[model samples]
Target: MASPSSLLSQEQIQCICLDIFTSPISTPCGHNFCMACIGGYWDSSDVCQCPLCKETFYRRPDLCINRTLKEISEQFKTRLSLFEEQYAQPGQVPCDICTGSKLRAVKSCLVCLASYCQTHLEPHQRVGTMKTHKLIEPVSNLEDRLCKKHQRVLELFCREDQTFVCVLCNETDHRTHNTVPAERECTEMKVSFL
Candidate 1:
């Protein structure tokens, strides 16, 4: 018998299965599966609990395409869009450091000088992992967001004295520049810049 972790990892598209099971037609959470898997793996189990996840399925399992699978597929499409935005430069080479596995680059950190796809990004935010990486989506205008020099935090807003400032900047450069809150400036700037 395959280990539970290995079982879930198998049969996933490119080993990227978020959730998958074998027997009992169940999910990792241990629901039940009959109708859903019968059409796919009927010869194996007329009634099967998810071998990968260990979920239990009730009798007379309903035959339906797995919505969970559909959702994951859609998420992959989004990842692709994010990758395009992050690597927008002409002739931008494929991510060489990432094992050449094609995944969506969903985030970038101006400070860290690194780009991360969906797979690596999650582990970066995980509790036990280092949380040093900053993440931003495509629509956040991350290209123009960095400081021309430091390239640290994005330029969020300027003070009343018109000094570009981040939250940290308030305490450093623009401390005496009649600082107005960024939220208020954002509200006003939207009308003109938008």
Candidate 2:
């Protein structure tokens, strides 16, 4: 008999919980993510890439809900809720580092790309190199911030292609395209709307 934790690992829970596990879908590459998560991700980009393996699919494949996984996930969720009420606070991201009792995350490190609770985040505050790491409010779907092709953080927006690009991407595929820091693009668009 598999333990509850073994039945659903932290990574699996993250993927399922981030998108509420509604209508779970499996890709041809054998990766599973919430249907809404993959749909929204593909809708924003030009290509269909698996969030976990970064496998690109030229055409969008037919999606079907995995009834068995869904049922198991639902059962697990019910059991977890019954085990601990108010496990995660309202509007708070759960600390990925916590094992038994997941705690609310206080900060997220961009360098490590992981959320940490107040206790686990101490190293970032105390260590010199870690102190330089950018910390922001906890965010789900950290993988979306990465470039699929280069596997680097998307920091720039390509005006010509109208998509996010990483630093390395700017030097390669988008070298000719007008590009600017993502922040600058946001600022420009906001100013234009005013």
Candidate 3:
């Protein structure tokens, strides 16, 4: 497949490129423009015509989204995002799935033990099984959530030790100690602060 840059000329891309390609439409004259761009242009003028070709239409044609063009635009955007993310800032979490150019992660899944960009994170949001996984703001240190001894996610806080502990840790080392869910512990600390 031709790269997005090779598929569309620089001028064509610029003509159609708005803030982002929301709805792309193709004119009967075989030219494509963003739906809003065409609508806005026509709304201000006396005649409806292709912006590029200036081929006037006697009557306003019903515009439908150009699915193929839209798909191409989407692919272009993904490639652009990946290109941008390749130079991600020092603190940003790079997406694990992105190979050559890793995009900044929007969410980190504890179950998957992976960070994902907005595009790559869609499956986690849509899939029923993945939806139940604990998703947190992107954090570089995933190992902090795992117990060194138990190799399980540290979900509980041992009040006595003042540290995170996994379920097995509560059963073993913290058997006689006061423990609570990390969220509960955090809430209690916040209440105390207030």
> How many clashes does each candidate structure show, in the order listed?
20, 0, 0
Candidate that would win on lDDT: 3
lDDT per residue as tens, model 3, 122-162: 99889999889999899888888999997898889999999
Residue 43 error, candidate 2, Å? 61
Better of 2 and 3 by lDDT: 3
- Superposed by TM-score, candidate 2 places the C-alpha of residue 96 at a distance from the truth, in angstroms, of 1.1
Q: Is candidate 1 or candidate 3 better by lDDT?
A: 3
TM-score of each: 0.36, 0.50, 0.55
Off by over 4 Å in 1: 1-102, 129-133, 139-144, 148-151, 161-163, 166-169, 180-188, 191-194
Compare the candidates by TM-score and give the number of the best one: 3
Query: In lDDT terms, how accurate is model 1?
Result: 0.50
Decoy 2 TM-score against native: 0.50
Ordering by lDDT: 3, 2, 1
Query: Which ten residues in a row are the worst by lDDT in model 3?
Result: 9-18
